[model samples]
Target: MPLGTIVRLLGKQSQMGYLDEVYNSVEDLSSDYFQTKACKAMLLKPLNAASSHCHRLKINIDDTKPREVYVCKDTSCYAHCAFSSVPDTLCKCGKVMEYAGDRPENDAKTAAAGSDNGVFVIGSQKFITTDDLQIGNVKIKVLQTRINSAVLYAEVGHDFVDLVFGLLSVPLGCVTKALSQRLSKGCIDNLYRSIAGSAEGCMGPDYKRMLLAPELAPFFGSGASQILEAAESAPKKIKVDSRFSCFKIGGFSNLGRCREQAYRYNSSYGCNRHEFTYCQNTTKTAEICELDPKLHGVQNSNCDAYVKQGPQSFMVTDDLHVRPLTLDSSLRVVSEGKVQMKDLVEKEVALTKLQIMELQRAALMTCEALSSVLLPPKKKKKNLKHLMY
Candidate 1:
């Protein structure tokens, strides 16, 4: 867990009666006792809620488009809106919701949501998995990679390695929002929800998108791995309303001039009567009017990459420990897992968008990302079907 997450959890628990809880030592505070206490509040939500912690509604987990959910007029219960099927507008908390009829517009990101830029293929690699979630070094056997049985490690080239290493540049808010707060970290989900709810009407859509789904800093993105799927925001430009038009200083008569006879101010700022130009407002002094809106959007970015391209092959363990592929390193991993040659089997795993997302989520929460995401589930295990998106 991040230090910020820990600090926020501690702060919240302190007010909820941390002093009364019994613990053997200060280290015990990090145990499940406190974690359960924190999650206890959200337990009141519906077991199948397809929304976020802030009561924002979504049709499903991968509902990229944010829907306008009904809110309670009274403060009885701020839980998410739930349908009772018998004309009762009940909240997830079982309280009647006073309908606030105004449904705001969807978030700005909705426009670009699900818009694929192009096919992003990471790399090709051969992997082996074992039933007990441990495996050993074996003869180099290449086969079609499979996703369902990768309970061990992956041997990959620099492309896949660069993609994994590129995960550091992703914003935590984007990941949390992408996962819909299934991050299972400190109340980061709640914090993100609180900020989102508080800034709904106060902030612009662009600002809201920035807060919730911030993009990588200019020139710092990996083109090979957009698993997080955060679209780069277009440059925001101020548009001149039709109520006002640009006049050449004292050239009000120029409005009727032909395109060639127009006297307008042109500058080296790349504004050839395109971007911002001298114009008098309706009731104010001379201001600027925008003709074309693409001036400021030209950002000089290189390859949208961070790591240098190379031929280095690496081994990523189930626990996400990345190391160069060498006999010594492979031997150490196999010895640690206590795996044998007989217990291992190879599979072809494709680093697609969805698979990468699962890997990213597992990497954030546990060391056993491979086992947790790729390992087949037991028969009795209950899956989060609503969150499958």
Candidate 2:
């Protein structure tokens, strides 16, 4: 009996299940890809900068097989899509990138390490609390405090506040795993662990892998405050030559249909399949070289910064509420909480990937997410000379 037999017996409609999931992801692999071309145009660099920085996916098309092409000219790609390995100008498909050979023969093979987007590199610029989110030497101001035992809210930038709010965007599986199942998140941890490597027939390993460490949805992610280990995967695209192909091939048989003014068939004067062409000769398969894949409508899979709204000083409450920061709101936190002015402490800590996990767990378990993750401020030593005077 089929698995849906019980449902069928109950007089409910059901369809046969299959192992394969067939869908044309590259349905719009043409139409000039104006979106991607435009996105590339936007990622500008300084005139003094030696190398170019493009945070976009390249469409790599073989004879028919198309895949993603990852390229980073700089040795240090602090933020990148997918897994960025040693910056060697090596595209994801192992093709030596065009820039790898740009330098001298000996200097081209310089050593490079894997990307560590977890922490800010030494001496690198930090984010300033301004509307532009400018890069400068700045520190994270006091965002929260504790007077005696009660914790009070602190004013923070939109990026800083995102460290706590990003929890909602994360999937349940990632939430549980990132916290190492330390948080009390019901039985989700068990459900994630119970999935076996092999499925009887209904699914494959890819499903399991995706569930284990799912990537963020396309074009959605933390701009610079990437506390979580989530990233967007490569884009989906069609073959480069897929403007059109043979009728038998491009007529929705093995491949998808061709584009407008881009259809071809046998070239025989009276060939039965020769509907688009005017005249021709033999119907040999080698003559199949003339046709290309008719690909159109493909949009740019590139992504922009997650938060592009005009910069504003965003305030976050203990209960994870986000809003614009104002003098009244800041005063309200102090008035309502009754936290002492001198009691509030500000300390700078690296918001690395691991620390992000702690934030996620604390956000779920308690309202004081910032205070929960932040260690108690250390007491400073008294100035002996000044105090004595």
* Residue 225 error, candidate 2, Å: 9.3
Q: Lowest summed lDDT over 10 consecutive residues: which window, candidate 1?
A: 41-50
Off by over 4 Å in 2: 1-139, 143-148, 196-203, 223-226, 238-304, 309-311, 340-352, 375-389
lDDT string, candidate 1, 177-279, tens digits: 7878566654667667755774245444554665577664322245323666755433222211221122221122333321324345566655545433323
Q: Write the per-residue lDDT of candidate 2 for residues 74-179, one digit (tens) a residue.
A: 3233322222111222333333322111111122211121132211121233323333221111124444554424445545554554343333334445555566
Q: Which runs in model 1 stand beyond 4 Å of their true positions?
A: 1-150, 202-206, 223-225, 232-302, 379-389
Best prediction by lDDT: 1
Overall lDDT per candidate, in order of appearance: 0.39, 0.35
State each candidate's clash count: 8, 16
RMSD of each: 22.8, 20.6
- Quote the lDDT for 178 in model 1: 82
